[model samples]
Target: MSKLACAAEAGMLPGMFKRVVVFWALLVGAGWSAGLPLSPKEVVVVYNANQPDSKKLAEVYRDARNIPQDHLIGLELSAEQDISYDEYQKTLVAPLRKTFDDRAWWKRSKNPEGLIIPVQNEIRVVVLMRGVPLRIKPSPLPEGVKVDPKDPIGGRTESAVDSELAIFGIDGLPVQGALKNQYFQSKKSIREANLPFLMLTARIDAASESTCERMIQDAVEAEKTGLWGRAYIDIANKFPQGDNWLEAIAKKNLEIGIPTVVDRFNDTLPLNYPMTDASIYYGWYDWNVSGPFLNGKFYFKKGAVAIHLHSFSAEQLRNPSKNWSAGLLERGAAVTVGNVYEPYLHLTHWFDVLHDRLLDGNSWVEACWMAMPVTSWQGVVLGDPLYRPFLHLNGDGKMLAEDKDYLLLRSAAMRWGNDPEEFNKQLGMAAERLKSGTVSEALGLDLLAAGKDTQAAVWFRNAKEHFEKAEDKLRQDLHLIAIDRKAGRKAAAVQEIREAQARYGPMPEAKALAGWLDILEPPAPPKALPK
Candidate 1:
């Protein structure tokens, strides 16, 4: 029967028969069709065309894989709209979904076996800014209290005590246990008497360096009420003894169950060499060796989807040479050529290639690390408007390089971070870049890491998109077959399982997702007993 006739007939069937018959017809028809075989898995990718480097990088992936021109989808975001988070999501994500949904190839078919996988691609840009200053209120002082500068205890100590008393007034002793409860009262009295001006000035000009000490003591006393137990403990541990400041702080905080420094406290320390561990410190060290220290930790916490080249030795940076960067890539990283007097030239070359591949709507991931200099010169340069997103690393105090090449790399990374739309775009790019039929297979590994069957199913669909060739198709099929057996998607997840087996052969993930789907989907009704 003709496909349209079969479709019409299947549509006429009542209830579940229509769905079952349609699916079977499509499967049988595909076996007889003369067209190129479909892949079991699918993939999608997203990118910003405004970034020349990103565009270039996509191209390189495409050329390397020999993807067809028509298969790629390039989505460009305007520079003005790209800077705003809301604008990027609305302008980019919405159009992307529409483009895929509108494709004729994705429409439901009469053939029972045919499946249409839904995927999306998008790109985003990020802009960075400097830290804003905190606002602090003035202190207050008591009346009829005069400072004696010549006293051993110091004029500042007496002034501060007097201020505390004035702020608290006669109600101070009674409210001692409920410091927080009394705080507003004290503040109210200080404000009413306008005692802040004199007390603040005296505190600032104090001869004795015991203000911090006194503050700690008062805080400790306040904790007796248990109203500020945790806060009091934390405040007391800020100052640590011993020559090694980092170790001391670490020890002190550890005792109080606070593993990291407070945001406000971190601001007080010098930007460079802030932490005690010099070798592992990100801000103070050179990028090549020191970069990994920060990268590893950042990836552990924030889950970096892409990686870049930093300051690895010359031997580790090149291909067809003594050093190999693939080890890092294998561990979910990407490298850029480093140490060239003109790093941008090399970076631009790679970016061009990557952009082309992404444009093809294939499945692929790119990584790059910039070797930012730890100098004020670099900071000043990065502060310019052009390098907004690449201003500084999250933990590092130094600014990133402001050059367009580096900025492009930084922009891509930030765009991908925690953004679902951007991730879908990259998946599309990965789909088109499967050489040796390995892209889909490789993606299965990442899907497993995701720990969500639905998400893995989406990724599998992306893998199948570019797997039209027999070898690529078969490779993807096997992966799906495996996924089926493990995840038990025998029914609901049958689409993914069957696709994987059809394209790649067998897949553990396909089996797993299928098993899970079966468990989730209700069982079919038993045959009628009456006969």
Candidate 2:
């Protein structure tokens, strides 16, 4: 039986008593019965009930897993109470404790052997901020500072209202005060146990000018309390100004020692114009500004480890070509090149690929690997099939593949060839010999021709992998470490460097990689919170 089926059966089995009785009977009748291997437990998703989006978010978990409705649980919290921060803490502790207890039980039931597996591995909590503003601030408005009356910015002071502020935090001094207290208390409880939590802070009044300040303040508070490891800011559009705002908050969080995250691309595209041109959409200028942020050096320097680059459509890549769409692989490569940041690209194109067969309905995994060629920044000239027409008989009357030295010459001719037949012939020969060592060498040269450092790293990796399989350890070791270092695997690359040093004595490149890794590792976790 499959592992999932076994898990489902185990879950469907009766209580402990019944299971024990069956085990006893099996033991008596069959003399010995092997214990079943445990199934990988399903993830438990929790969201606040009060938020309208709460159900939708919870549904995402269920729909993703296709689990029975009963498997999902929703916890609803009352947003009506107006109390001091301390009182709010007292009010939430009891219910939160109950939820924790229930979660523990659910986790325990999944493990028939009673092994103490981490609940986080099986439980994911999506804390929806209901009736909370996207941003928070100290009340008692400054003179002449009126909360917009038409907006009724504070109308939901007593009951939950359909205001954007209510989307993230509560209204009025008391409700807002209560939420702050609850937030810290809950954070303390979760962090004390070293639990992971995801906070999606959204506001109804997302476009309002004051929202940015509140987001910044809240981030500062969260960092101070160690409440969340990751923070997601969801806004209406993709404004460059919005990115600037996030950069500012990321800066502030770093100063106070907080790991702040900005969830770009969660909403619609922010730009007013259509992003259908590769030059316009994946321009290097925007990346030049954002790249430093990824390297932990831009506006505010914090030892931030990673950032997420999400793209909902391949259309976001904006390739005019009909044969190949500019997908995450292309965009990611471009972003990495332009900005020198290696952020994970969340490709939403797989959904379209699966449903529409736009890209042969290849699973996301296959798509990712196919895109790896692009991600490695190898230009389309080498990989695209359209260039196959250029391989014609030379004056000396020799097929291009007959001589290794001629590969680059042939590729160059194909790249610059005017006639479709000549391009296709050359491309065909190159494509046919893709796995040949000569072809690999030719690809490396092509990358050099393109002056793509990142693509050189990829070629190095491919060459190393092939050479290693043929027992060429020295060449394999050299190229693998080089590629790893170039691709942000600094620590892994360092390990390879150390191995090389031990194996071959002090090599210059190995020593350099070691030094670079030493500089790249983040400082040890802070001993005490920043003053």
Q: How do the predictions measure up, each by TM-score? A: 0.19, 0.24
All candidates: CA RMSD (Å): 30.8, 24.7
lDDT of each: 0.26, 0.29
Q: For residues 1-531, write the lDDT of model 1, one tens digit per residue.
A: 432343244232233234434544444454421112112112222335555543443344334334344434456655331122234335443554455456532322222334322222111111111110001112222455555656422222111111221121111122111111111112122123232211110011011113212222322222221110010001112322211323333333223222122112211111111121110111111233322222222211111112222222122222212221222222222111222111222221122222222212111211111112110000010001111111122111122121111112222233443564453344334334322122333234334434444555555555556444443343344345435544654553456544444543343222333343344454788888995
- Determine the C-alpha RMSD for candidate 1 after optimal superposition of all C-alphas: 30.8
Q: Candidate 2 regions off by >4 Å?
A: 1-42, 67-73, 76-94, 106-531
For residues 1-531, what per-residue lDDT tens digits would candidate 2 score against the true structure?
332233233232233224333433443354321112111132333344676554554454345335446444455544432222333334333444355566562232223454332344233222222222111112344356445566432322222111111111111223321121112212121223233221211111112213222322332222222121222222324545434534444333323222222223333222211111111012111221222122211121111111222321111112312112222222211111111112122211112111111012121112222222112111111111101011111111222222322323332342434453443344334433444333343344344333455664565555544442322233335445545654677778778756765774543223333333444554577699678
Total backbone collisions, model 2: 29
After superposing candidate 1 on the true structure, give the runs of residues whose Cα lies further than 4 Å from its correct spot: 1-41, 80-85, 105-531
Determine the C-alpha RMSD for candidate 2 after optimal superposition of all C-alphas: 24.7
